[model samples]
Target: MDQVPGSPQEPQDARGDDGLPGCYRHPDRPTGIRCTRCDRPICPECMVSASVGFQCPDCVRGGSGTGHAPRASVPRTIAGGTIAANPRLITMILMGINIAVFIAMTLDDGRLLGDLVMLGRTPPGYLPEGVAEGQWYRLVTAMFLHQQFAHIAFNMLSLWWLGPPLEAALGRLRFIALYLLAGLGGSALSYLLAAPSQPSLGASGAIFGLLGATAVLLRRLNYDMKPVLILLGLNLAFTFLWPHIAWQAHVGGLIVGAAVAFGMVHAPRDRRTLVQAATCAVALLAIAAVVWVRTLQLVG
Candidate 1:
């Protein structure tokens, strides 16, 4: 098959019958340009513009040893070296735990209307003994137990409403710490003030703590405090007017929550963690001191 040199080559059309080249990724779509890196025809939708020229999606994404540089990392929520996609994850988990505990309590007790209440005074059940008898765990457990549907409902609603924002404002660790400390403060005050024989249980103390923290933080931001003040007043009134309500717990939680929030908002940026830790420690110590004094008085 000998051929003459410089013979005319057959003319070939780069475009298809539609007068444009079919896209490499989408055979139905037509494109006039090709990827600079891979030289693959791509439609506008599949094209990613590079500094020098355009690139196909595959080339831009560095597909299959294409040797393109990896893209920058996406933004993520990183708190104290912990990564989470959702900022409100901790708040949701706390809510779920509370609901699960309530369900378990209801199932175990066989009485939906009453029972499962934790009392400050010693009774026939476990962990109900007063602080005087060194039943300290009661302080923590009492915060999770609620008597009536309305009781848990109101408290959980408050938590759901306030928890996410507070959790976001204060990192997960700090938020959880604040919640527990406030609940402990409430229990301690209840133990000190409530009759030694009286019984009490509810998450109202923690909810009140949230409310108090919100008030303090808002005030620190120099926002108007009238709305919070009115809400606080109404809740206080309800606490006093309602029967079997533990006003002592509410007041104690409010005070401690506010104090902790104050420290959190006022601390210097360089020493925030240290100041918050110290503030929490001092608040817990104060509660313990009050309990110790009250226990001594009761024992004497």
Candidate 2:
């Protein structure tokens, strides 16, 4: 059911065609009841009955037992998402998946890699494969696939270093969204630019996305930007100079990640959820358009 503001107590007559405000916890659900303490809009599920009005989960949790609203600070991340006890949970799961996939690739030889690696369109002699031939899944799988030791090691190390902090700051959901979108951005660009038969795979694009996000977050928090900028510069240099590196992936992921993180952290408090969703939607739509155009080129 669509959540719209107004109940018998909080009737539709009061809303007067105003834009629906999403519940801070569940953005899809619309609600009119604002928390007595934080003033964040809340759905019935997240609303706890206070002495006067409903309180949000955070307020209830932080509030003292005297039925008074919380004086303590709510546990929320920089991006306004609830902080998790284990900040690195998503990162750990992602690393596990990558490691498991790597082990599978090792045990099964290049068979898994052949299927999972990113390919645009197979050459004439090759079997029907790649995105042009309707095997678009290669784009998603490729980011997690790795056949080489050094490749996985570098990416995993980068993930270990960068993933936890971003996860802590952005919260798990936003962090994962940023990571996947960044990887997909990388994959899409690689597909668009690389030759059809040019097989590529790695989490470097995702890593680079995190790198870009780290820089953005650092700058947003008023931290020194020189370290990340210098690191980005060095990586860019290596990407161009090194053989077998798909620089397109790095560039694409960085752009998308930084853009998404910007929206996540910088959205106006009143419109944070909508703005964040819109930002991700825009990035996805852009990638989809790129994929469509490239598909036409490859098949035509």
Candidate 3:
């Protein structure tokens, strides 16, 4: 009896001289031999003789092969167990607030006051031609003002896209602190750059800080930032082309944001969160000093 190639061996009803199933490797009517490749019982006719022993037809011709191993998936959480571990929700909320304020500024009759308080544009300090000395409170307020729909729309869109990842990395409180500090930093920079009589207002500075934060965090986390760098470049180019644009605020915010992100991402793992927060506090104080000096100058 002879067996066919690639067939599994079964117990022979009639055994050969060696008491084994017949394999096809031999031309004899009966020769019991096991295929070395599959280890299956074969008759002499089915066996494909290899150098060491008989190989199965599938192994001999290489008709079938073992598949490559699949890659493992990445885990969801970091060591800290942060849920979803990204601050997208926080980003949306901040964008919403900015948009709402912009709408209010558009609707309100007291446009100049909105510019002063929401954008920190103190006319007496920077512009010198404004009415009163006691109106320095606008330094903090002016950060929230936007002169046009396009201005707020652009800033909020940037914030919406960039804010969540940073908020997630820094956590909620630190994210908020960095944002406010960045705004103040931008306003201070604008004050420094603007002529004594020019009024400046907008959230672009704060949004620029978010870009800075993104750059620093991505670098520290070993994340790729090709897309973000391109976006930042485009915005900067636009700033240079547009004369009314406040380049000072954007630069200031970027520097402060980078500093804040560095403190957060690179501080000792045990003390990183606290250190990042302190960095924001320091930025705020620096801006506060500017506000204080400007106020005194206005008062005099």
- Candidate achieving the largest lDDT: 2
TM-score of each: 0.68, 0.77, 0.64
Question: Compared to the true structure, candidate 3 yields what TM-score?
Answer: 0.64
What stretches of model 1 exceed 4 Å from their correct place? 1-84, 110-118, 123-128
What residue runs in model 2 are displaced by over 4 Å at the alpha carbon?
1-74
lDDT of each: 0.68, 0.80, 0.61
Pairs that clash in candidate 2 = none
> Higher-lDDT candidate among 1 and 3?
1
Off by over 4 Å in 3: 1-86, 110-134, 293-300
Candidate 2 lDDT, 48-112, residue by residue in tens: 44445556656656562344444535555657676676778999999999999999999997888
> What lDDT tens digits, residue by residue, belong to model 1 across residues 1-300?
112122112222346655776666455655566766667665433444444344554554443224554541321111111222354677787777777778877787644313344444554465435656666777787788775788888898889887865665566677788888888889889988998767667788888898999888667544457878899999999999999899999998888888887787566555667888899999999989988887787776
Better of 2 and 3 by TM-score: 2
113-153: candidate 3 lDDT, tens digit per residue: 43464232344345433312445455556677777777787
Q: Report the Cα lDDT for candidate 2.
A: 0.80
- Deviation from native of the Cα of residue 259 in model 1, angstroms: 0.4
